[model samples]
Structure formats: C-alpha cells, structure tokens
Target: MSEKFEIRREVVVPGTPEQIWAAISAETAGWMFPSPLEIPADGSRPDSPIIADWEPPRELAIHMQGPDGWFNNLEYVVEARDESTAVVRYVHAGVFAEDWDNQYDGASKHTDFYLHSLGQYVQYFAGRPVTYVSAEGPEASSAPEAMGALRGALGIASGATAGDTVTVDVPGIGTVEAIIDYIDDWFVGLRTENALLRFYGRNAFGGNVDAAHHLFAADADGDAATAAWQAWLSGVFA
Candidate 1:
C-alpha cells in the first residue's frame, strides 16, 4: 500500500471563489512561493509525465513524477460554504521507499509554503484599506510643490501634460488607470476609479470593486505606486 499524507487548512478571505481561482491559476509560479519552480528557459510548462484533473470551484488533482523516480499524486480541493470562508485540502500519495522520507519532507515544506502564501495572497488581493499622506497640509503654501515632488517620486514625468492617464500594472492582479486627478500645493491624488472600473470588466464584473479598491488603496503610496503599477502590468501581460 502507498503511504498517504493530507494537510488541510481553512482561510477566511474577503473575496469570492472566482478571485481565489484567479490567484492560483496565475501564470507566475512564484505567486505561490518565494522562488518559482524552474521550468524550460522558454517558459513552457515542462513536459513532465504529469496529468491534471480540474473541476472549478471544487477540486484539482495531479499525478506526476517525484524525485528519485518516484511517482506522486497530489490533490487540491476547495470547499466554499459562503462568500467569506473556504476550506482547502492538499493530499499526497506515493509508494513507500527508503528515500520516501526525504521526498515527503521536501514536498510537505513546499506545499505548506504554497498554501499559506496563497491564503495571504487571496486576502490581500481581496481588498485592504490603505492611507496616503503628504508632506504638506492641504492649505500649506508649498502644497503644490510637495505634490510635484510626490508625482515625481511616483515616476510621473515632471513634464507630463494634464489629462494624461498612466496605466498602473500589477502581477496576479490587473492593470489600473492612474489619472493625474490634480496636482496642488498640498497633495497629489491619482484617480484610479477608472482603472478599478476596467478591472471589473475583465473579471467578468465579479462585483468585487471593494477588493480591487483595497488593492489599489494598499498600493497607492509614494514610490510604491510605481512598483504596484509594474506588477499589475506583468500580471496582465503574463
């Protein structure tokens, strides 16, 4: 008989089933881990003798080769009871062997990291509140100058003409439009409502702008906005 191990975890997220799926199914492997699996240099899913079985919002199964010529079976199942909670289970099976212990340890570590990271990612992408601060107060005499500095820090060109909107891209997330709403002496507030609106369109209008808004809010800080923008672009283009 094959040795079996199962790990189950429940994560409460402020997102829907669709949102969870999007994160897991993202093209970038690192979304689930700090270091992604190395595949072909051409970026193709390896032609390993692995098979996948997927049933959306429910289950996914894979049978693949393990280290030392071992064969392993892995299954991931999602059970959603409501809009805010889900139980995910990961199960592994393989034949027992002298090297089985090592394989199991490595697999367990990687899978655990993947699951934990995924949960955190889902929660984060599901909208989190963020705050912005300016060096000068709204009524300060140098507010406009401070706003210019803020915009420049965010990589918005100092000479960028008015009415120009820049696409802020994020990976595993999508692109958001950052309209230079207004640059005053006190602060610069980039309007991303349109970007949020556009995201809704691609996500089948999942009716979760609250989550998207949270994502933008968390990212709409100082130079961080530029990094967030680039991440969104990579996710979209990837």
Candidate 2:
C-alpha cells in the first residue's frame, strides 16, 4: 500500500513576486536541480500532468498522476509584500510506496533545505547560471563518523553553527573563505564568494553521505568539479 504526504513551507525573501516566480520557474537551476520546469505549450496533459493553475508572478501549480493512483503535486503561491520583497508559499505533496515514516521525514526535512537555498539564491545569486556537481561517498560513508570526518576536513568545529566565517581548503578546487549558511545534524551549507556548497549526512536516513556544489562562476567546469569532489569523497570514506 502507498502512503500520502504533503510538505508546506513559506519563505520571506528580498525579491519581488516576479523575481520569485522566475526563480522557481525558469531559473530553478540557480537554486534547485538542473532540470528545466517545462510547461506544455499545447495546454494539454502530457505525461499525466495538468497545469492546474498558471498565473504568472503570482501562482503556479502542476499535478501528475501515476497508473496506480500515485500522484505528485507542486504548488507555489507568491505574494508581494512591497516593491522589494515577497513571500513564497510552497507545497509538495506526493505518495510513497513504502517506508512511509522514513520517507516523510526525509522529504520534509529536504524541503526546508531546498527552500532555504531558494532564499539564498534570490537574495544573492539570482538569475546566475550554475554548474551543479554531485558526488556520493563510498560504502563506509554510512558509518556514523563519516559526516564528522568531512566537517573536520573543512576545519569546522563540532559545535559550529550558521553565520560563522571560516576558510575552507577545497580539495583540487582551491581555498575559499566561506560563511556557514546553514547547518544541522544531517546537512551543512557553505556560502563562498561564488558558490553554494552542500553536504548531506544521508547516513541518518539510511544512505551514504553526499556532497553537492553549486558553482556560480562564469567559467565553472562541472566535469572537473565532479571529478575532484568524487575523489575527495572516496578518500574521506576510505
């Protein structure tokens, strides 16, 4: 049997409604994943989807259904606070095939991180192109000390919190002075001069550790970044 889940989060950021809409729509790669948010040009359902709502600079919603009554939906309602700020109300609803509790917990927490990243992108790096590099650590990453080792490698102390400044020696990438943008037991976010670095302690959720880099430099090289990070992760978990 499948289980249903819905995650809602609201964020107030320094951007107009139009800007927020663009960030979530056309410029999603700046903060979220690399896939484009495609809306069908014909106004018809394709891939079992319906564009339930489409009001530019205000609201957008999409719903998709699977053959076995499984459905996933995304909705964003942007409200302008003034000329320079807006509030984004987002909802992510879906069904999971199994492991209902664990799935819901991970998905809900992931929403928080993604929304925080969205605010960061809108505030600082809005509309910039990004080269996203993701790497999975070795099997030993599931060990409890895996994330701690990576943090120690970056010179972050055990009790570090957001907003602390530190210089990071990024392996094969170069050294950078960064701010701890976000941190929790299962995640770490670093904001450098030109990139957002994210570390996922997925062992807390039954997976290996993962690292993702969102490089916003004009000359970013995704291939080299991925290769370097993968090697670093392998060494860390080995």
Candidate 3:
C-alpha cells in the first residue's frame, strides 16, 4: 500500500528573489545536488512533463507521476522580504510504498539541512563558481558510532555548535580553520574561507555516511578533492 505525505518548510535566505532563483534553478551544486536542469527561457514550458509551473524569481513547481498512481511534487515560492533578503516556502509532497514511516522521517529531516545549506550558500558564497566533490564512506559507516568517529577525525567536538571556530584536518589534504555553519544530529556543515563542507551521518537512516565539498576557490581542483575525501572516508570507516 502506498501512503501520501507532505513536508512544508520556510526559510529566510539572505539574498534577493533574483539571487535565490538563480541559486535554486541554476547553481544548485553550491548547496544541493548537482543535477543540472534546463529551464525554459521563453514563455513556453519546459519539454519535460515534470515541470508543472515555472514562474521565474517567484514560483517553480515540479510534479512527477508514476504509472502506479504514485506521485511526487516539489514546489518552491520565493518572496522578497527586502532588497537583499527573501523568504522561501518549500513544499514536498509525495507517496511512499513500504516502510513509509522511515522514508518520511528521513525526507523531512533532509529538507531541514538542505534548506539551511541553501541559505548559507546565498549568504556567504552567492554567485561564486563551485567545485563539488562527493564521496561515500565504507559499509562500516552504517554503524551508529560512525558520525562521532567522522567528527572526531575532523577535530570537531561532539558538542560543537554553529558559529564556533575550529581547525579541521582533512586527511590527504591539509588543515584549514573553519566555522561551524550548521550542526544537527544527522548533518554537520562547515564553512571555510574557500569552501562549504557537508558531512552526512546517514547511518541513522540505514545508509553509509557521506561527505561533500563545495569548493569556491578560484583554482579549485574537484578531482583532487574527490580523491582526498575518498581516502579520508575509507580511513574513517576502515
């Protein structure tokens, strides 16, 4: 049996409507996953049937319907709060099959972290080019202690909170001072001079942990970063 669910969240981003739209629509790699989307420029709708609505700088909606009567919809409404700020209302509605409770739980929590990262991107690194590198830890990361181990390896205290300054040593890379931009039971976000780093303790959701680096440095090397993080993750889970 399939069950329907809806998740709603509101976030205040430190960017204008235009900037927020660009970040969500085009520069998603900076905050979210790098799934490049081709939004229609003309008044016409995009070729993909998934796009239910497209009003740039204001509203964008996506609807995907499966043949088995299951569907998923994601909508974002961006409203100007001031000349340099905006409020975003996000809605994610979908249907889940088996283990729907766990699915819903994970999805809802993920929205919190992702949206926070979006706000961080708009506030700190708006309009900057990014090199995104991601790596997943070994199967041992499924253990409950994986998050603590990863944080320990990064030199971040278990009780660290946002706004605290700390120096992180990236194995195979070098040490860099950073501020804790966000932290929660399942996610940790770090902001450095040239990068935004995210660590996902996904073992709570029955998955291996993962790490991503969104490097905004002028001479960022995505390939090198990927290799270094992969090695680090392996070491942490080994």
Models 1 onward score TM values of 0.39, 0.91, 0.94
Would you list the rank order by TM-score, best first? 3, 2, 1
Query: Which is better, 1 or 2, measured by TM-score?
Result: 2
Please report the TM-score between candidate 2 and the true structure: 0.91
Which candidate has the highest lDDT of all?
Answer: 3
Query: Which ranges of candidate 3 are over 4 A from the true structure?
Result: 40-46
Model 3 CA lDDT for position 227? 95
Instruction: Give a tens-digit lDDT track for model 3, residues 1-238.
Output: 9989999999999999988987887788999889546755553445777888888889988888987889999999999998888999999998999888888899999999999999999989998999999999999999998888888877888678899888867766788788999887888899998899999988988898999889999998889899999998899889
Which model scores highest in TM-score?
3
Candidate 1 has an lDDT of 0.44
Q: What lDDT score belongs to each candidate, Candidate 1 first?
A: 0.44, 0.83, 0.88
Per-residue alpha-carbon lDDT of candidate 1 for residues 1-238, written as tens digits (9 for 90 to 100): 3455554445454456665644443322212311133345543444445537556656656686766656667676777758686766667766656555655554554455445445645654333333322111122222224334334434567667536777644443456467654333222334454222111111111111111222234344534544554443333323
